[model samples]
Target: MSKDFYSILGVEKTASDDEIKKAYRKLAHKHHPDKEGGDEAKFKEINGAYQTLSDKQKRQQYDQFGQTFEGANAGGAGGFNFDFGQSNAGGSGSGFEDLFSDLFSQTGFGGSASSQEKVGSDVAVDVEITFEEMALGTEKKVELYKRVLCDKCEGTGAKDKNTKTCETCGGAGKVHKTMRSMFGAIQQVVPCEKCHGKGQIPKEKCSKCGGDGVVRDYQKVNIKIPAGIEDGQTIRATGHGEIPIGGGHAGNLFITIHIKPDQNFKRSGDDIVSKVKISFSQAALGDKIDVGTIEGVIKMKIVAGTQSGDIFKIRNKGINREDRFGRGSHLVEIQVRTPENLSRDQKRLVKKLQEAGL
Candidate 1:
């Protein structure tokens, strides 16, 4: 229902085509329904807005009419159109597919379509790593229990496969489906159930996988977690997920990383921060102490008359850069701990010093 295409794409009305394209690409990637925490509703809205604004003629008409006309002035063969319950069963019906085709092409998103086979659905998993492990890239093996293509059948779903064009969808991999609505029957293009969007079916079903072309199995996939990867970021492992329902490019496995917090160190940019406590005597008179760094424990000096909240830097003692060419400095903050309980003799000595103004 949002009429402002510019506001939907987060751009000014006078924004250029490249600016609009940049905004659209960024927003589409962030809000893509395939990503975690993606919003499908918002994705649809942005798609509609971008579709209108991306066209020069449509953009001009939309600007003049302010979406109230919805470009009804241009009812030409090439202009965008939306009509329900009017499409015949034999002729082509349009709705979701038309919009998705245009948006997917513009956004450069693959795996949405198929030629001879269908791509599989993506799989997502969560992984946890220690701070050290995150700092240094590591490899891990993950065991996944999901549908895999039948090895015996070679994903053709038949011992000796012979393909026949699907009569139901007429080899289109999609069919016009009509559903009743309050206004009337709404028709939309949906994947054909019989052929499963492959546009063809095997002559005979495989005994092991039956006609599905996939079986429930366990697969071990080794993932190379790179250094400097942020938490909540997803890593896509190509062809490491479930096999396509019919057969095409295998789906990607998306791994979301969670980093465990370290007790002694905290991350700040590329630097590591840690706090150390020193006695009042060490702060006032200065002392040498062993401080822990990412490399190891090193002796550090506490300057004389150092006050609380003093910071000391250890060069190149923090996390390594992604390229491992250099490292960030470790910052150590000092806290002075005063004596909580004093003996009678100690109190008397302190009182004498106070009286002498020492």
Candidate 2:
């Protein structure tokens, strides 16, 4: 049957192979007979189009020869069919059933892999940063001892960089197993344990990776700490984790930041809170004095009649706002110092004032 594969999938002719595959996956999921209001005929048509358009040579032939060309190419794939919903339930459908089975096993929706390549394990480490470091963005390098791609063999897992097809599963890299489950005897296509899902085998294995394509080694990873990052927040470093055995993607590195508390200053949101001690004379007479802050020391006015424990604000003296929308002020709580012992002259002056009041 002739079909406008692009129109059926609703993609432009200029779309890339990825776009075509993505469109096919979307339509296939929508029309799958298992879901409510599913349509079998429409599902078949979509699947048929994808089957022909996904392959490079076949796609090229179809694009040049017209829609009818797909039928000839899809002869094998079309002959094989299993009910999408029921193939797993209890049916022993043959041919394309196993193909569909493996396709569904991919991650997410359209995670295409010739042989299900596994993702590596993630690495996590806690890093401590000073309070000042939090205010200012900084970068840190962490020491890690973990699996990495083999430099000697370039992760080919072959000693001589050559391999023959695994004897167990041939070049298919999968073994069909008959197992008993709730449904009954279901034929399952699993990765060949011997070849580890690589269709071909290297003639010689790389000694460093032991044919697994990775080795446990030391690495120094550099991570960036953005300004205003809160304590105990984790930063994810992509592809910094362990190496996959079959030459796939590396996992991620998670960095948990711990901010060390500063005794002289406390952070309240974006604002810096602190306390300052002023002499009784300074507080009473309203003198200007230097107050220590994150932005060095700045002169602050001690207002006249400033009482103990009174809070004063110094504008733009706190942590700089991350958004660059001005800055937070330093909230300084004032503490007035009182002398415990008075000198004879001080006592006489105090007595004269008391007597005058009396």
Number of the top TM-score candidate: 2
User: In terms of TM-score, how similar is model 2 to the real structure?
Assistant: 0.66
Residues 1-358, candidate 1, lDDT per residue (tens digit)? 5458899999999998778767876787778666789876676566567667766666888888887855464334232332422232233322234433433432212334333245677788888988776766677788888789888788778756766788997887776666543223334455677887778777888888887889889988899898666778889999887786766667789999888888998888777889999997899799999999877899999999988998999888777766767877889999999767999998897788779995
Q: What's the CA RMSD for each of the models?
A: 11.1, 8.7
**Where in model 1 is the C-alpha error above 4 Å?**
1-116, 160-192, 323-325, 343-358
The candidate scoring highest on lDDT is 2
User: For model 1, what is the alpha-carbon lDDT of residue 127?
Assistant: 88
The residue ranges of model 2 lying beyond 4 angstroms of the native Cα positions read 1-115, 172-192, 321-324, 347-358
Cα lDDT of candidate 2 equals 0.73
Please give, for residues 59-113, the per-residue lDDT of candidate 2 as tens digits.
7888898766865755453232222233233433323334555434644111443
